[model samples]
Target chain A: MTVTSLPHDAALSARHPGELGLRESATFDRATIADIQRAAATGVYDIRGWGAKRSVPHFDDLLFLGASMSRYPLEGYRERCDTDIVLGDRHASKPLHLQTPVTIAGMSFGALSANAKEALGRGASEVGTSTTTGDGGMTPEERGQSKHLVYQYLPSRYGMNPDDLRKADAIEIVLGQGAKPGGGGMLLGQKITERVAGMRTLPVGIDQRSASRHPDWTGPDDLEIKIGELREITDWKKPIYVKVGASRPYYDTALAVKSGADVIVVDGMQGGTAATQQVFIENVGIPTLAAIPQAVQALQELGVHRKVQLIVSGGIRTGADVAKAMALGADAVAIGTAALIALGDNDPRYAAEYAALGSAAGYYDDFQDGRDPAGISTQDPELSSRLDPVAGGRRIANYLRVLTMEAQTIARACGKSHLRNLEPEDLVALTIEAAAMARVPLAGTSWIPGAR
Target chain B: MVTLIGTETPAYVPAASGATATLVDLAESTVRDLNQALHEPHVQGEWTVTNSDGKHSIAVGIDAPVSVTIEGHVGYYAAGMHQKGDVIIRGNAGVGLAENIMSGTVHVTGDASQSAAATGHGGLVVIDGNAGARCGISMKGVDIVVGGSIGHMSAFMAQAGRLVVCGDAGDALGDSIYEARIYVKGTVASLGADCVEKPMGGEHLEELGQLLAAAGRTEQPSEFKRYGSARNLYHFHVDNSTAY
Candidate 1:
């Protein structure tokens, strides 16, 4: 039982693992060993925030082909490349007409502070986009700040109000998110403040476990009746959105449409959660790149590709990701983890405080602890007050502008007048796995791995 | 076989509340049309629906201060999301009867399917006949009075409200119940995790009596037993794994 240990001050010194003739086992990794020890010690699996940390083939593996010798290109600065998108116009008389195709995804108030929710609303409103209210139901601050608010209809039905339903711009029925496809929401007792408890109708400082299955309805068959009921309740005015984790994308999308959804939101594996089992987050659901084509194929088979809009989410970051999603046949893209980043979560400016909490700025994922140094994911009055909603909103608006502009730059270069016009023909995959998932041709070749 | 039981009229009419009620025949028109008429902002007086042969969503989402009477059997979500209205179903109701009701009253004279009055924020739901599984599930601040027995999982995860059952309760009665109070006059099949029997004090008896009277039931409060949450599984712990 001889164990080779590092020198006592090796971390402070210049000596490296490789230099010390040591090799780290990829299978029996340090992180894996630590995780085993953690499980053995606590007898409970790790439950934390954020999405899948493992590497998967993503949008970065695909490259865009700018207009070349045979094709033409639009002027970068002057030519009009439209980024405007309309969602849920099929049945909704009042569909959301936004200036950009990037929208903010639903993040609950219990997971994030009220200030953060307000900031997200203000940010989305500034850019003529929509923000959504999550499981704790709609808060006044969020509703007041958001111009176009989508009230989420979760199984919990916490703080669900008829008055708020009428006030919302649209209704999104959430089947599951990508982080934990079959799991329910978790707001540990530490984060459950008096206000959160009042809203959730639970005792103060109690761990709230939301139900995974909806109380009334079951599968797609019952979902159809449920959608109809909602339509009747809202007078057929608000758009009905069906959101699902990207597991069986084609079947889910088709079923959603059959269930009378005007809009379908598909969240891929990289989608973030406030708090969930680590195993579930990493194990369930497919990646964003693989999900788009299947969802699009379903819509295309039903002759409602763009008619019944598709909003792809989970790990969408830069304008490239947005453009890649649209090119792969999504009507729009939603940002959750990236939106929190824009709101100053995990910022290096809070490095000292995050380190004091036994986490670094970029590595902090203990959102369930409810002691966020960035103040974006905590309910503590002092911690939440650190974030000024107005200023945070400005940062988000700026980030959104960058993403939209970068997407427009690519669209103009590809000779597309509108973002929706960008197609798979303009894309080439850098890797075979990516080509197979994206259903695109490999770089410098005419072959699509799976199709060929 | 789309038979017209009555003469079809426009979906929505102007504000007019006469002694003669607004008559809507499901066979003559469609469920969408009936709902549109109910949604009319200035709607007043009573609405009488006929030929409701297991038609779903009959007289749903009535927001105005009005009364509706469905003459025949109705399907799922009858009088759902009810606010400021009084709806009476003369026959059996399918699943999700009066779901998410905000205010007003929904009375189902015959038996109801699953999830009756589930997630109701506020209001009173009276089921004169037996209610199927998950009746009053996740109820929030809504009073549900069942004259007959309720099936399995009744009052499961009920948040805040009073559920008065005049007859026997099926399996897992009041499972994971929160602040909601359940008073059952008949024998219970089983108690769910974290749900336990509690002695009915004077206040509970008074409350049960009030609810029974409001629901127009003559059941004596003394015959009923109260069940509530034990507050043990409220916080997460390893010892509660079996309960979970």
Candidate 2:
């Protein structure tokens, strides 16, 4: 005497195929099937924005060992926990002294709207951290709002001038980004506004292809001379930072240091991009959790570990992520995708709008389409006005404060007075994969899977 | 007493002309001393750089409307990013000579190495002797007049500038170039992708004549063959995938 009710339409029960007794294959998953169909439908490969969506070893796998019996914890609000950091004192006369170690990574004005750029500058400035310029070059809106601006010197040299070079707080020589290390970025004609075209010195509404390699120098030997040229251009005043995508972290870091870099910025594969092939994004480069130790080892071997500052970036989100990155030997951590989320990307309020674009709220990553509902990644004047720069700046400033406070809380619990003092000894990996990647011991065991 | 004229104290002597003369001896002081002085505000004079024996970045980033003459050969990036300043290299120049020059003139009396006047926004670059590979590569708005032959891949991706090569051009000239015009008096090995030999018209002749005259060359504009972008590879297409 079982009363089974099946009153709804077939479409209403369509969410799960498992109810039909169809076993889902892990190898050829639903997402993979859709990807194959997409390639078949369109002759072009899938181009989207965002970091690696695939699961891999990351920071969440590592847990902090808070003080219990052996060490005493600092009183939550009574004892002090500092988070200040100084970057790039190796060659430059002036170095950046940040209140918090967390800085904003490079995002171009063209990739983001003017309002978004202004908001990022305002937010980073409010928290006494540095903001960076990207490929398209510096804009007046961003330069005006940012307190400490680090200008990026790329291969394209778009909108690059002597006056702008001298105006920067620090100069970063960008070799590659984390999303696609050996590949260049593409800005579709839809996003290339008149202003962007003017800055880049390209045709209006033309798709611009950024060069992968530098036009002037050839190799590291030539890079050394190029560094000297930049130093001579600014009269050795601004700090020179060399940024590389995480691949051969050990060799790349050592070469950067050898090339006379005041700082090395290693970006992992989880780093976001304005536009890139989905395959390149998912396949290329290693993870942030794995890159830090290798970079640290290289710097330490060179006897200039702390001297040459290391700023790691890719998938930094929360305070725990920040603290964990620092404990792994990063002088500082940079945020990109998380910062955009804080500034209202993929917001639930724009769920309907995202659905119209064939995406959901949290699933929207078409930064290349230039039809961003959140007003952050679009150049449309009406959509750009949707995000009030002042309001967005405040939200991000609050988020940054929370991040800093949370890191401080973790540091206090770890019995460390400073965030940098939370070393590898205070961290343990929850899984053998993370243990091997982070080079830390697995949870209760004293054995690291990879360590000899 | 060995005196570092331009490094410690700038020796400004009133020449016969209205412009003052300042001598910078690289042997006496470092290149930093010379460049630092040139970067200072209100720098207006005729400067002479002596003993610049293959020094890199000697007299780079000069913004003043002064004239700098390097008496000897120099290494990489000699007179890079100079604006309003007229830099003259008396001997052979090494890699990246006058790289990213915004305005004014860079004249090399001897052979210049790779990437001469690369990414130059404006002004004129005159090379008297044969230039190495990638001459005027990615040149933007700068008029480069080479008196002798240029090496391979010359004028590749040259944008919005006039490159007048008085001698023969090397292989793959004007590869994937945009908006720029090239006039060569001698034989080209081959044209690169998206580059073709355009008919030399009246406007081309006059412009080439002016550039040649500016570079102080006697080659008639009629003898030169004009080349430019075929406007094929400006936009990407799957049909033209093999060219890239």
TM-score of chain B of each: 0.92, 0.93
What docking tier does model 2 reach?
A: medium
What lDDT does the true structure give each of the candidates? 0.90, 0.89
lDDT of 2 by residue, A230-299 (tens): 9999999999999999999999999999999999999999999999999999999999999999999999
Evaluated against the true structure, the overall lDDT of model 2 is: 0.89
Give stretches of model 2 more than 4 Å off. A1-15, B1-20
Q: What fraction of the reference interface contacts is present in each model, in order?
A: 0.71, 0.38
How high is each candidate's TM-score?
Answer: 0.95, 0.95
Give candidate 1 misplaced runs (Cα > 4 Å). Answer: A1-14, B1-19
Q: Residue A185 lDDT in model 1?
A: 86
Of candidate 2 chain A, the 10-residue stretch with the lowest lDDT total is A1-10
DockQ of model 1 vs. true complex: 0.67
After the best TM-score superposition of candidate 2, give how far the Cα of residue A388 lies from its true spot, in angstroms.
1.5
